[model samples]
Target: MEKEHKHHISSYFAHGTVLVTLLVLTVITVVVAGLKLGPLSVFVALIIASIKGTTVLTYFMHLKYDKPIYRIMVFGVFLLFALIIGITFIDYVFR
Candidate 1:
């Protein structure tokens, strides 16, 4: 017989908290977009987006309670994406 692994169930309060945080972040993003900070607006938007993405991945996607391998894979993918973006920017700058 195989042993079944029990999953951790998140509370409604936790989900609500995440939802509220995402909503707040959305408002902040909109406010930042209205500021017209030139290049800095994009950077601020990206940072806020990253935070919202991480929150969704951790809570709604249940990545926080997932196995180590899954977390590692997600982190690797994020790292790869960041590296690609960095390289693209560098190429653009040098051209």
Candidate 2:
């Protein structure tokens, strides 16, 4: 007979932390959407939205508790995205 070992990979969060964060982010999004920041507003909104999205995905999706491979996958996705963004900027700025 073989002994099996179990590990706890999940996190137990304090209740409503996510809900509160969501409400706050929603308010920020709405408020920022209403304000006019000229050409920079779009960029700001996207950045802020990304932050909110990351928070949701990381915490809600339990990405934080995933295996190392999951982390690598996320890094790879972001790295590819960053490469594309960097290339676009370089091309735009140099042109």
Candidate 3:
């Protein structure tokens, strides 16, 4: 017996909104790059990039409509990645 998969169809307006939001984020990234924030600039850029990546994953990739377990797994993976990066950053700072 095969289980039926329910498809979540996103509206055109919603996609358009997402596109506009991404464009706005890109603009913000450009603006941030032009500023001389020094060490904080990289952190800010990473934050913005993360937001953009999440937006793409959630809407464009239809991860938002996936099962809860899948979402939790993705979150865990991201957390692990962050932890590794944090550790690497700490090591670099101390060296």
Candidate 4:
């Protein structure tokens, strides 16, 4: 007989908290966008977006309770994407 694995169940409060945090972040993003910081506006937006994405991935996606391998894979993908974006930015700058 195979042993059944138990999954970690997140509480309703935790989900509510995450939802509130995401909502607050969304408001901040909108406020930042309205600031008209020129080139910095995009950078600020990206930073805020990345934070929101991480929060969603960690809590809502249940990555926080997953195995270490899954975390590593997600991080690797994020890094690869960042690297590609960096390279593209560099190419654009040089052009």
Question: Ten residues in a row with the worst lDDT in model 1?
Answer: 1-10
Tens digit of per-residue lDDT, candidate 2, span 1-95: 64554544443463268767878888988898889888888888888788877887777776766666777899799999989999999989999
TM-score of 2: 0.72
Give candidate 1 misplaced runs (Cα > 4 Å).
Answer: 1-4
RMSD of 3: 1.8
Estimate the overall C-alpha local distance difference test score of candidate 3. 0.92
| TM-score for all models, in order of appearance | 0.90, 0.72, 0.87, 0.90
**How do these models rank on lDDT, best leading?**
1, 4, 3, 2
Error of 3 at 31 (Å): 0.8
TM-score of 4: 0.90
Error of 2 at 28 (Å): 0.6
Q: By summed lDDT, which 10 consecutive residues of candidate 2 come out lowest?
A: 6-15
Clashing pairs in 4: none
Better of 3 and 4 by TM-score: 4
Write one digit per residue (lDDT tens) for candidate 1, span 1-95.
65567898999999999999999999999999999999999999999999999999999999999887788999999999989999999989999
In TM-score terms, candidate 3 sits at 0.87
What are the root-mean-square deviations of the candidates from the true structure over C-alphas? 2.0, 4.1, 1.8, 2.3
Position 76, candidate 1: lDDT: 100
The lDDT leader among the candidates is: 1
lDDT of 4 by residue, 16-87 (tens): 999999999999999999999999999999999999999999998999998877899999999999899999
